[model samples]
Structure formats: C-alpha cells, structure tokens
Target: MLIMGEVHTGLLRNLGELSETECREVLRLTSGEEPRTWQRPLLYAISPDVLTGVDCRLPSSSGARIRGTGTVSHRATIVGGRVLQGSSYTTLLRSDSDQRLPWSHYLAAPGVVEVYGRPRWQDMADGFVTPEPPMDVLNVGAISGRLMGAVQDSARLDRKTPFKTTRTRLRWLFERDDARGDGRPAMRLTLGRDTMRTLRFTGEPTTDVVAFCEDLALHDWLLTTLQTLIQRALIGTAAPAQIAARLSPAIDHLLHLWMPGARVEEPFLPFWEELERHPGFTRQWTSSVARIRDQITVNTLSLLSVTESRREADGDPSPRRGVPQDRTQSHSHPVRRRIFFRADQRSRRRS
Candidate 1:
C-alpha cells in the first residue's frame, strides 16, 4: 500500500487570536458535521472533512505516464486559535479493472486513488518527494493551498498579521517496511527552502496516518519558524534593546506553542522517540527558546543599569542603595515572572 499527503502551515493573518467560539465560526466547512474543538493539552479546532476529485496523471519516479482517478480528502485546522494548517492526502492502490471507471465509483471510496495499471507504489512514493515534480502530475499541495486560501480570505479574519511570514509545504510518503518485515519502522526527513519531504517505512497498521503526519508537520514548522526568528533577531551581534524588539512577537505568539507529538497515535510513539534521540527536536527548541529569554534578560538588566547610573548622577533623593522602593511605584509595574511578556518595570527604577 502507498499513501501520500501534503500539508501547508502558517500563521493566520489576523490581528488577534481567535477564541473558541470564533474558531468554530471560522472552521464550519460542512453543514452537518460540527468542527471538532478541544482544549486539554492545547486549544485547537479541526474542520470537517472535505473531498476533491481528480482524474489526472499520477506522479512516478520513472517518469511513467500513469493515470489515476479518485477523491482526495482535505481539511483545515486552527492550533491554539493562532496558527492555521490545511491538509490533503489520498491513498493509492490497483483497481480491479484496468479500464477507467466512472466518477461515482471513485466517489464511493473517499481518499483512495486507483491507478489504471499495476500500482507502482515505489515509483509513486519516490516521485512525490522528488525535488522537481513534473508539470502534469498530482499536485496535492495546490489542493491544500486552496483550502488555506478559503480560510485566509474569510470575513472573520482582519487580514492583518502580527509579523510577516509565508506558509511552508510538507509532502510526505508512507509505505510498508517490506525489506525489514520485522514490524519495525523508520523515517527520513529532508528540509528545503520553504518545502520539506518525509518518507516513512512502517510495518504496523497505521490507522491515523493523516493526523500523525499533520502533527509532525506542525512541529517541523515550529522549528523552522523559530530558526528564522532567531536569525532575524541577530541577538548576540545586535543591541540588546534592538534584539528584544525583534523577539517580542515570538514570545507573544510562538514560544508557548511547542508541543511535539501531541496528537500522534500510540503506534507512532517509537518514531517520535527515535527522532528525539537523534536530531532532538525538543533539544533544539529548548536551546533556541533559552537564547531568546537570555537576550530579553540582558535587555532588562541593561535598562536597569542605565536607570541607576542616571539616578546617581542626578543625586536623586532616596533612603540608600539597599533600601526598598516606595510603595507607589512598586505595585504599579509588576516584575515579569517568566519574561513571557514585556518588561515594563522601568517605572520601578524611576525616581
């Protein structure tokens, strides 16, 4: 069996994060099926499943002109009421008949694409992660992008974003671990400029393929976005205040949203564990987050040092160096406990 899918992840172009009610109002894609909303580990909402039909040339590693017809399932999701993602995928198999089938026949099995000839599973899987896909091939990314556009163009959003960012594409392929045949799994991931490719070999019956891949895509995107933010901030090279200004939006929007494998199935736990053991997704995230916080702390200390220097130069009235501040300013500007928010404690240092 061969399965292929694509996901597009980005920050929703909205002025403020949507509330639970607002998320539901935006994700109501189908009439009868209510969008699933949850808040246990994270606050998120998933739109009802939507299907799209395709009768076109299937992608093949050997450049073979293989025709396929079936429906591709697509859906939209909102994470923490802030980020938006569109996912689309279709499984492939050989059909009973070699001849082309009617549209009704394909519609019967949603998200299953059948080839006219022998199902070239390897060719299809390889072609999907190819660097240069053909012009006349199955473009799952386009199908996902349209759904993303639909939500981005909705009236609920203000079409304004906190910071400039573009969506990323993650194309993934999965197949049975035939060579090993030992009920083990392995995965390979490649990162490109604004694009990614993931290929997996699994022996277990992975029931929640789409959901698990979507979770992986989400975490990958988080890592990618944080890398960009840090590079743009230029923390060590730039002025402390300047770096702090560049990283403010990250603290407000991105830092608190790094939950890996939050929605993965039990069968895929080994894959996640292996990934952590090597590339260390959580380790990279932890290091980057610590860098941002350290820069913010330096900025805070710089502000305080400058304030005290000015006070001593002006001979400001005060009890002593070790004395506590007056009660008026003490309660006004509270100290930042976690530094997740801006440090507005300059008032505490003022005369």
Candidate 2:
C-alpha cells in the first residue's frame, strides 16, 4: 500500500530552485554526513532503512528535487510561540508496487543553522504547498532512460524495467546538537550549498529556450498580476481587504487560459479560497514568472535573430495578451459585482 502525508517545511521546494551542482552538493553533504546502508554515493541514510537522494533532472526553469527511499523520521518544535516542524521522508519500495512508500515520520526535534549572507525564503512557500508526489522527477528519469534504452519497448514509457531498475536511496538527519542557550534549534534542517558535477542534457538545442518562455507567457502574466497586487498591498495604498476580495475572480480569469477548472462560476467565496485550493499556483507563479523574465532578457540579446525568424514565419504581432484595464474600464472587469448583479449588463466575453 502507498503511504503519504503532509509536512509544513519547504526545504525540498527551495532546493528545487538551486542549480544542478547545488543539488548534487546537497546530496553529497546529506550522504556524507549520514551514509546509507546502500552502497551508492548518491544515497543518504536517514535511518537504518530510510534513504534520500536526488530523483530528477534540474528543470530548465529551476532546480529542486529530493527523493528518498526507506523509513522517514519526523519531528516538531515550539519556538517563539510558533510551531516549527520538519520531517524526513523514508522512501521505501515494495515488490508489489512501483510507487515508493513515504514514511510519515518526523525528527524528534528541530535543528539550527546559521544564516549565511543575505537570506531569501521565496521558494520556501512552494514547500508548504506540499507536492503531489515526485512525478516530474520520475518523468525526467523515465524520459532519459527511454531514449537510452538497450531494449526499447514501444508500449513502455519507463525504460528502466523491474529487472534493470537503478535503485537510488537518500536520507537526512535532523539532530538537535545543542539544547540550551541560543533560541535556535541545535540542528536545523535547511539547504546547504556544496560543490557538485553537472550532468549535460541528452540533446543539444532540440528546442530553443526562448520559444518555451513564449508559450508560458499566460502563466507568467498571472504571477505578474498577483505580484502587483501583493506589492500594492504591501505599500498600504491598496487595501488588503479589497485586494483579497478581487483575488478569486482575478485568479479564475487568469488561470482559465491554462486550466479550465480555474474558471469558477462563483467569484467571492472566501477571498483566499482560490489560493488555498490551488497551492500549485504559487509554485508555478514563482518559477514561471522568473523564467519569463529571464527569457525576455535572453530574447532581448538575441532580438535580431528572433525578429528575423518571426518575420520569416509571419507570427502574430498582437501584444502577447495580459494587460490590466484602466479604472475607466471597470465596467469590463469580472469582479465588478454590479455587472454580475445585472444580467442584462453583462458583456458577452471570452478570456
């Protein structure tokens, strides 16, 4: 049977944001500090049976992935009136199922680490969202293995068969090294950067990164909208209450392009409901927004080439969608309750 549970920390998510070398460093440190029973250098022993390691390739957008196989250890702590909890998943495999069973365990207590240089916690939020298993990681491995398969099977996507499976393990140790004096935990679980070797992609330039970013423009626009709303709220010029009120309808209309479920009939249910329901929104929001910005910079440098290519293909020159309406155009806004209240006034519209 498959077992899974939610943890509040975002360590894994933040780790995903790091580069491939950084990820390997995490694996190295984790493995070196706590060697697994398994012989592989990539695997770390969280406990006698639990192991943790990197399970996927670095997304062209960001890098953060942690895969564990074995029994997990989990723990909780109370600090400054707030609860800080961290868990180590023991990824274990069974003969009956291909899925790895996550042991819902926690460290006995929280650990502590010194904050080095300027600290950024943006990616940490993705961690709290709690991912829906490591499907992307598994996909990356499968995609690679399929192309390099010794015996290709047309019906099988996971090229690594049961008999040819490359078993990798990973583990983490969250130990309380100090119990007194400093308010921080003696051993806190946070990402530590270390040196690692880079693994090259299988093919060179099969697809240009610029085109990929263009495809994700809609998703980027949503993040930009939310970020603007957040900035306004932070400045106190925009009411948090009002901004929250408009969040759902805004998210719905924004996400409708990529996700049909985002187009809900109801706009005002609790303001935070959309954010709460679609936790992945935040993850994609951060990564996609950064990716679009990066690609725009790259495209700008290669603008001449992109322009010439576009000219050759005769691509649409229309503005790439997503621009906020003026206050004068409030009548066209979806969150305007008066329009919804008046069916006759509603404009026939398509996002």
By lDDT, the best candidate is: 1
Tens digit per residue, CA lDDT, model 1, 13-79:
8989899988898889888889999996888899998999988899889998998889889999999
Q: In model 2, which runs have C-alpha deviations exceeding 4 angstroms?
A: 9-17, 30-70, 73-87, 90-351
What TM-score does each of the candidates earn? 0.88, 0.19
Best by TM-score: 1
Sliding window of 10 residues with minimal summed lDDT for model 1: 333-342
- Candidate-wise lDDT, in order: 0.79, 0.26
Global fold similarity of model 2 (TM-score): 0.19
Model 1 local distance difference test score: 0.79
Cα shift from native, residue 142, model 2 (Å): 32
